[model samples]
Target: MDTLSFNHTALTAPNRTVEVGGRRLAYRRFGHGPNLVLCVRFRGTMDSWDPLFLDLLARDFTVNVFDYSGLGLSTGKPSYVKTDMAQDVDDLVTALGLGKVAIAGWSIGGIAAQVFAALHPEKVSHVLAIGTMPPGLMVKPSAPLFLQTAFKPENGIEDQYILFFEPDSARSRAAGDASVARIASRSMVVDAITPPAVMIQSVIESADPTTPFPDPDGRYQAFYRSTDIPVLALSGDHDIMFPVENWYAMNDLWPTLFVVTWPDSGHGPQHQYPELSADLIASFVKNNPRPV
Candidate 1:
């Protein structure tokens, strides 16, 4: 297959909607090659992606970024359970006729990706988890309390600074600003933020102490161990939310996992270093061939 040339202009392309499993899903598909499905972070919309980052990935793969049901323009009840969200992704993939795709997820989306891979192992060629906590591990919040406050729906800019950019690093802050600007260039029209009730429910469900992995081992180690699918885990060294230590812990369990950490970045490493992050993901997929 001929790889599509990276097009910066596509970053501002409009999104379309498709019905999946009786609910409408808002999505944008660009570039061409092997399919790559991106699951967004908590309370994120399809427009939330950084243009430069998406453009880079689009150079080598058909990238599909979509909003979860009930978020953005998608219509349905929101799901708090990671597994349920994963199923939604599966439904969308099936609806689009995207066969055996490479999957990447950020933050809570990473958790959903893992579940999706586990539940539908035959459908995934590879898995990439970014700025995610270890599966089934309920750790204390790595970010400051004020950072949580900054995540309020009305505080979009501040939320980006606190959640995505490294606080003390001017360079990282500038990158965050640039990403926000790039997103803005796509459209001044912003979708309604995910409802606080849904967001709170998701947070509570994800962090519930009594609920770990479904298996007896209390972790997803068995699932990772048994699967031959390549897994790449990436995070920011300075990430205040789900810190790099979380990746380290996950790596400790799955020794075969490929891991990387961006220096001086926070929760959103891709936003801080779009070029490098895109290169890393594209390279990983190229290097790890799917089984014949």
Candidate 2:
């Protein structure tokens, strides 16, 4: 099934495209087992994810990661609207003939994942949200440094340390550096880095999706609450961008939800501990199968 990757790992996987709704979605797929579609963060391309994390996930599942419409390699009217992102996911999945697949998203992409699950419950089996806040209200505000660092045209190891890792912890900082290096170690990069203009618009113009499905009182509350699908959110205890506390406050709200926060870590816990994160995700997906 995988003609591009010889070892079934994300690192060596070649680029591919699938046309959907007039949009050419750029994607890469490797490994074996059930399908897992991953969505990247703000200003992130398909090349943005750490290969260590992706390769680890590939061990247990067929991993699919892609660029959003008009970002990176995807061709379409560029937008950061949550509904448009959800549409991208739905169109790409249907175009690729992937049915009932598990979905994972990081940062703002997590919001896109929630929207997708709420709108297309039949197409999704499990939802894995990494380093993202729950919908509605945030228990605490995000760190100002996040906006400062994210708006940069290019990020170096130091910027990454500030954005994704706990600078106070030498261990966490080192882990962040290693993760960044691994992502750059790719011999072939299929996706383009998102430019500064796109980054600014993506963050500023992003909109949350409203539920078209019914909820309690015949009105919408939280999108995740509208679906019975099992949702797992992975985060760092010290995530400056999206605090894990917000997720805890809404723990009792969602019908089926789980959270995992790694200590001394920041926004990208999956990157800091790729193997452990991947293993936990594999166990979660294997244990929770969507009702047929």
Best by TM-score: 2
lDDT (10s digit) by residue, model 1, range 37-85: 9999877777778878888888888888888877778888776477777
The pairs that clash in candidate 2 are none
At residue 292, candidate 2 shows an lDDT of 66
lDDT of each: 0.77, 0.83
Clashes of 1: 0
Pairs of residues at least 3 apart in sequence or in different chains that clash in candidate 1: none
Could you give candidate 2's per-residue lDDT for residues 147-218 as a string of tens digits?
799888887888898888898999998898799889889886567766778767765666434321113242
What TM-score does each of the candidates earn? 0.88, 0.92
